[model samples]
Target chain A: MQANRSRFLTIMLTLGLAFFYVPMILLVIYSFNYSKIVPVWGGWSLRWYRELFESAEVWSAVTLSLQIAFVNATFATMLGLLAGLAMVRFGRFRGRTLFGGMIVAPLVMPEVITGLSLLVFFISLNQLTGWPAERGFTTITIAHITFSMAYVAVTIQARLTGMGEDLEEAAADLGARPLKVLTAITIPRLTPALISGWLLAFTLSLDDLVIASFVTGPGSNTLPILIFSRIRTGLRPDINALATIVILVISICVAIAAILMFRQQRAEMRDQKMAEGADE
Target chain B: MTASNSVSATPWSDTDGQKPLVELRGVTKKFGDVTAVDNIDLDIYAGELFCLLGGSGCGKSTLLRMLAGFESLNSGSIKIDGVDMSDVPAYDRPTNMMFQSYALFPHMSVAKNIAFGLQQDRVPKNDIADRVQDILKLVELQDYGKRKPSQLSGGQRQRVALARALVKQPKLLLLDEPLAALDKKLRKHTQFELANIQEKVGVTFVVVTHDQEEAMTLSSRMAVMDAGRLQQIGTPTEVYEFPESRFVADFIGSANIFEGRVTEDGADHVRVQTDVCDVFIDHGQSVKEGGKIWVALRPEKIHITKSDTPVTGENQVSGVVDDIGYLGETSIYKILLPNDQIIDVTAPNQTRPMNRQHLITWEDKVNISWEPSSAMLLTS
Candidate 1:
């Protein structure tokens, strides 16, 4: 009976993984296809890749997306850190419930509604102040920060709650003022959470489509927006080539992060073993 | 006996004229509707290792936090080194606390952790290094200076915490359950080490702990707190031998209490009548005749012998041994009197039994007697 159960589990696991990865694997294989049509499997070649590299529009969109993701990740992480600290560390405030609701509203709100409301808010602000006269890079970046910061804040909040106030109190008792304790103890201890929050924000901003589509104006086409618009017409081999490169880059980044985390865990285990040995 | 006469007779330190290093006047703290620390007044002498002993939620830790400037007083003032500390922040206060969790900075090396306070104070680079090295040697962790807190054992982490708080050389150092995390054997060893360090540094140490034995062993003087109120403050011997109330008598160690009404309150001795028998107390108390009182006798102070042995004493009772617990060095006996009241008596097993038979076996009739000088009269 145990062997039968194990066999069934193995089959299910394989089927589940195949369901998730097979399409991506197929897309990657087709990116190398030399045929003009997607389904026609010609000999393997880099024709689509060369065409993708030569396309100035794709390059411009990639650059714009990178810029927006960079700015959004930085600002979102900073804002998220403040929000997380306020939620976890600051005992209580008068408007704490409202502040918490607003911070987390973006997480649960429909992307279309959030995008539309933000678009309306920005148009009214422009009408009143004559500022941000046109919606483009700045508007998209701002919109991305609003949504991406929620993910970062949640991640940081989990880490901060687990990291109790004892260390900070100890720091203060050791004569460091509040701000000094933040810099000297709290921030350094929060390095792992901050790094992960930044990475998540960057990925979310890069992957955004609906919000960017609502806020973005002419001359500030993000990679997702460009690919989304082109797909409306029809799928192209160049777009497939672009997607394959993005998949490869993301896989490499994820692999690097996993390796780093594994190394840290191993180091901690070694330290614990050494501590136990010393205790004995 | 007169209350003032008994107060002077207790064996605790009397800070009659010496200037106290830390003083709290009417210090009170409340959380919502619950009082965490009620109106409390305390004076701790300079260079004294004082302990605030209590059970969980007894407000000992809250009192320590107030002393460390971590918690603001609700309606009182704390003075340290003759300076009113109401407005002083924890960072600016001349005090440091070794947290119950140790709270050693995980990211920093032992040397860096020790040097942190000095850096915060803007001490010179060379002095910080020298002080850190000195503290490392003091804690006997000289070679482990470069190791992070995670790389150290529980005891080592505790020492690192001690070194970090002590390296600052603050006027007063507060330790909250400092040795609570260690195992039994390590706790015993660290207790003395901590006392010795406090003596060596000459810093006034205020420790908060729930362990009665820890408080008795570590502090020269300790304040017992219960229900957010000060129960008694005295030396270990004073608190143990003459507890001010029934709570102190029961909490400090095992005590067999006889609830009764005072029959006589003389200048030298007091007598109380209970269900089992009449209890004779050694000292006089301010309690009136016919008033409710309790006579507390320490377990070890009672002498147990076979029932047939003809023993005459001022405070004597005969009962059957209900239970016998043979601890390694001593044995505890629970004796049940004819009145159905059970009393605990502990006796040292000076000689080991050759056979399975103990000197006092279970269900054996025995006579337990204690001297009048050993009995305490308590009226609350």
Candidate 2:
């Protein structure tokens, strides 16, 4: 009975993984299909790939998405870094808890609400200041930064909480002033979280579609928005080709990061062994 | 500043020996209804390993934080090297603090963490590197300078914290539970190293800890605190041999206390009548007639013998041996008196009995006694 239960659980886990991956596998297989239709596999060919590269709209949208992601990630990370430090370090002021809640509120709230509110905020600002009359790249980037900043702040806040107050105190004791301690000790110690936060915010901005749709003007559509519009017109082989390439790129980046982290761990173990040997 | 090698308590040099490194005059700190530090007055000289020893919530940490300029003083003034530091912020304070957590920067290399203070002070890049290298060598962490704090063990991280604090050469150094995180063996070694470092640097070292042994081992003069009030402050020997109150005697070391009434008072020796026994206490302080007082005797001072020899001490009690606890170096025997008082006497394990017939039985009558000078009088 135990063996049978074990076999049944193995089958369930395999089916679960396959159920999740079957579509992506089909998409990969179909990206090379000679025919444009999906599901019905034709002889292997790179016709969609060729088409995808040749499409000016797709390339332009990809570039725009990258640009927006870069700007959004940079701004979001900066804002999150400051806010996270303030929340963790100078936590004595009244309304601090409330303000911290507001900073992270976007992480749980619906993206549609965030997009609509940001659009309204931008419109009011434009009316009041007579500036940024057009909402396109700037508005989309701003909206992405606003929501993505919450993720960055949360990640950084965890790191800051664990970082403790000693490093900063130690730095100050060594004759570093307040600003120097922040830059030299606190910021350096926070680098890993900062990098992870930037990458997360960048990915979030790149994946944004609803917010882009609400805030983006003409000629400023992101890749996700472009893909959604294309899918609506009717599923295209080119869309599958783009999806396959994106999936591959993201997986490769993740794999490389994992390998590097593993190697770092092994090296640290080796160094520890050597130190022990020296001590002995 | 160089220290004078003379043994006249002038460990750290000050102009004309008039200025203390840190002085707290009627310093008090309160949080709402909580009095964390209550009217503390202290004068810590330079190069003295001054320890603020107390239990948790006894305001030792609060007093240390106030010295570090992290907490505001509710009343009284704090002066560092003769400069009033009432409004001085932590960032502006001339003193450096070693946190209880050791708080090394997790992301930066050991060298970078050590150099953080220099960089903040806007020191030249080359000078910062030189100083970092110097401090790394001082802590014997020169080879581990490239390692992150997470990669280092607890001891190494402690050294990094020490190097970081000492590199600045501040007017005073504050340590909060400096060796509390270490194991017993490492703590012992670190205690001597800490004392050596303080002597070499000639900076005033103020350590706050709950470990009585650590305070007794490392401090030149230590203060015992209870309920946010300073209980007693003196050398370890003075505090141990001549405790002013029951709290100080009980907190610093184990003592066998007996409540008694004064039956005889003399110039140097006083006889007291206890419930179970009579005790003669020799103290310098005067006592009133028929005054109630408590007499304290250390466990080692109480000797136990099966035979009643011609004893010369003024106090003696005969009791049955209740239990025997064999420690590594000594054997502790609990003797139960007729009045149901159990007195513990620790004897060095110098002889081992070969036969069971010679073994001390559970109900063996033993004489427990101590000299008059060995007793301490504690009055409420």
Highest DockQ scorer: 1
lDDT of 1 by residue, B1-380 (tens): 66566443432244354577888899999999999999999888877789999999999999999988878889988999999999999889999999999998899998988998899999999999999999999999988998988999999999999999999899999999999999999999999999999889988899999999999999988999998899999888899998989999999997888789988889988888887678887777788899988888899998898876534445887889999898989999999887898999999999878996788898898998888788887886
Off by over 4 Å in 2: B1-7, B10-17, B106-157, B308-314, B352-361
Under the 3 Å rule for N, CA and C atoms, how many clashes does model 1 have? 2
CA RMSD of each candidate after superposition: 2.9, 3.5
**Residue A76 C-alpha lDDT in model 1:** 96
Query: List-wise, what DockQ does each model earn?
Result: 0.86, 0.38
* List of chain A TM-scores, every candidate: 0.96, 0.97
lDDT (tens digit, per residue) of candidate 2 on B1-380? 23554434643323465567688899999999999999988888877889999999999998998888778899999999899999877777889889899877666788887776666667899998999898888777888888877667778888988988888788888999999998888889989988988888887789999999999999999999999998998889989998999999889988888898988887777888887677876755588769999988888888778954433336787888899887757888888887898988888877776663435557787888888788888895
**Could you tell me which 10 consecutive residues in candidate 1 chain A have the lowest summed lDDT?**
A271-280
Pairs that clash in candidate 2 = A166-B103, A167-B103, A176-B117
